[model samples]
Target: MEFRVLGAVEATADGAPVDLGSRKQRLVLAVLLLDAGRPVSRDRLVDLLWPADPPASARGTVQALVSRIRAVFRAAGGPELVTEGPGY
Candidate 1:
């Protein structure tokens, strides 16, 4: 499994590109990768995902994005997305 954030946020498995879904999902993965091995708080993610006004469903949106990302990794037989405390 390889994650690239230098040029563009990208994930590849076995040399094949891994689809990361939407732009927001990719951003979530990038943020998490930047803080790898550390638990990123939900509030922090909310702020990053929506800097101006975060809707009431912002938390759920993050979770859904994480879930989608995890599914992609899981299907690709890559790394596991670990959930720690209030974050993923």
Candidate 2:
């Protein structure tokens, strides 16, 4: 998948369009792109996605969100879009 993130999110796979709906999903993708392939920490993702107060399952939610975003990338014929480590 080749993505261009300027004012909005747009991704194409083999010259075909890919749809990644939902505001939260967009937000997650936006943040990751903003980081320019750098691994985004789980804690940071949780905080950024749900500010003020987060749910008890915030961590899990962030992970699920990331997984969904990665699925979109794969569907677009791209490699796994995100990587995790000790810190990013």
TM-scores of all models?
0.96, 0.81
lDDT of 2 by residue, 37-57 (tens): 678888887888889999999
Note the Cα lDDT for every prediction shown.
0.91, 0.76
Clash pairs detected, candidate 1:
none
lDDT: which candidate is best? 1
User: Mind giving the per-residue lDDT tens digits that candidate 1 earns over 1-88?
Assistant: 9989987899888999989899999999999999998998888999999999999999999999999988998899978889899987
What ranges in model 2 sit over 4 Å off? 86-88
**What residue runs in model 1 are displaced by over 4 Å at the alpha carbon?**
none
Error of 1 at 59 (Å): 0.3
Residue 71 of model 1, lDDT score: 90
